[model samples]
Target: MKTSTELALSLNPAKPRCTQPRRWLAAIAVLSVSWPVLVWADCVDTRKATAAEVEFHGRAMAALVAALPPVPVGGKLQNKDSVTTLGQQCRGVTGDFNLEATRFYELNFRKAIVSVAINVRQLRTDAAGLSESYGVASPNRSAALRVNNVVWTVSGSDSPLRQALVDAMDRTRLQGWVDKPLPSVAESEALASQAVPAAVAVPATGAPASNASTVQTAPQPAVAPEPLREAVDAVNKLRGLFGR
Candidate 1:
């Protein structure tokens, strides 16, 4: 006698039912299609500041330094030697400078938030006196004058330092620091320029119920054609029909 399994297989020779594999494959295909859209939706565009922005910040810093009390003499003033001393003084003032810079950066570049720290140690005064006999005394004292490396930390989805620099340039009517010339308009006019446009909304496929507006309006009922008959015939027909 044949075994029970052999007898059963012989009775029903059709292919085995295996829906699990097909269901998994379909699920994977759907996931593959959807994953990219989700990733795209989450994507953000981040950009470094242009050279113009950097120059604008430098100019603004220079202006700030100019507005403050003049550097004192002897201690370190009015010569190449003064830059080191100036940096020392600037280091003292970095806390206040950073705060102001932070505020300025925010007001200008809303999308590109940034935190800035003025590194005064890197700045050096003019090196004009290097050739003179007195210049040989100390190698450390002769360097270029600067506010030092302005550590611009760009945070958020955008670069605020770049924005701040752009705004400051516009507001101050600065021009030609970068390769591009400033706009012909005044600072006020430049500020009145429009901001970046907002993104448009998109509908999802097979979402629980679409908004009613998407559905087309129902067409109005068509008017029936009048019966084809002369006026007298129509009247007679009506009279006959109504027995009047």
Candidate 2:
């Protein structure tokens, strides 16, 4: 027979077996809480790395511009055709000047084969009655840079949309914009415009026949023949003498 205490201890259910399932459940709960933090941390790290990359690229682009010869005011370094394309894109863009600027920069600069290409992805405009009512200055801009595909940008300036561009090149440095091969449309038009028509000759009408020996030429009627008139008179006199 057991003492009351021993009986109480025995009756107390054997410590519920801590099975693998319970351990797994605890692990899952811990992971569920920690996973978000880990994910957030990873996201932060990625953003920081991207920010650094952009800053480096921005600096490089700035340096390239600084090295270039000065471009005369009103004279663009990029080609006129490229500028035309940029203008077209700008005209089509609605409301966001920064977006237009970014697109223009990307088209004119980033993809260009010059010494440097700066892509300004987003920018902030301080104008009333714009889409966003809360018009606080924000660093909501992004850019992709390529000096042969090595990227760069302004730090703390990353936006999924709307940005401005700052180019560091001069007209001479940007001359590559013109150096790019002319588009086929312009070339073909130029060729077509320059082409000349083949020459052809036509014969004149009522001119003297080339073979003159085939027909007697008529005498021009400008003057009567005096010798023929005298001969006719002499013949009339000879006829009168023969009659006598």
Candidate 3:
């Protein structure tokens, strides 16, 4: 038995052939308009951040990695040409940015984001101390804040689902308290000053939606794991930009 679609096509054979191209064109148009909206969807279930966002941050991370003069882990930097080497590395890493980006964000994206925050904190501390000790101008570069904004922007703004995903994936089970939102240096330090409070699950009982859990927290630890050695090196190089 011929289907209704097939029967209709037999009656107007050219109709299907002509409409095929039109249908494809319409789909392409719709996707172009809706693409950004989908990017704002939950990164956990949707995992649909805009490709531009991913590519941008991936390149930035890679470039930043390259800019620093390499100091051996806990060893002093021996080369003055570290920034030059890093610049070349940045180009190399960013050459096939899509693949580099996949490796960047697949497992270690959050850790990279956190590392930026930590470095920002450390830089602020260093700047403050330098200003005080040398009576120099404030060197607040605002790198941390910029990095936070970009991370959240590309990754997706915080929503309940996003936080829950953080909970589900975190090995530390810190998903409850962390909310996994990037913090300003003040927020970071304030969190570190107090003992952590417990995370509370909102009762889904007789509720319209199933989303549960409210995080309550006292403070974040003053320190994150030592900043990525490469990132820290990049931060220091910014000193030359400022003629420090």
* Top candidate, metric TM-score: 1
- After TM-score superposition, what is the CA distance of residue 169 in candidate 3 from its true location, in Å? 35
Candidate 1 structure quality by residue, lDDT tens digits, 80-111? 21111121122212121221133211222233
The deviation in Å at residue 17 for candidate 2 is 3.6
**Clashes per model (N, Cα, C within 3 A):** 8, 8, 5
lDDT of 3 at 169: 28
Global lDDT of each candidate: 0.35, 0.34, 0.32
Off by over 4 Å in 3: 1-45, 72-244
TM-score, one value per model: 0.24, 0.18, 0.18
User: Using alpha carbons, what is the TM-score of model 1?
Assistant: 0.24
Candidate 1, residue 159: how far the Cα is off, in Å: 14
**What lDDT score is found at residue 7 in candidate 3?**
100
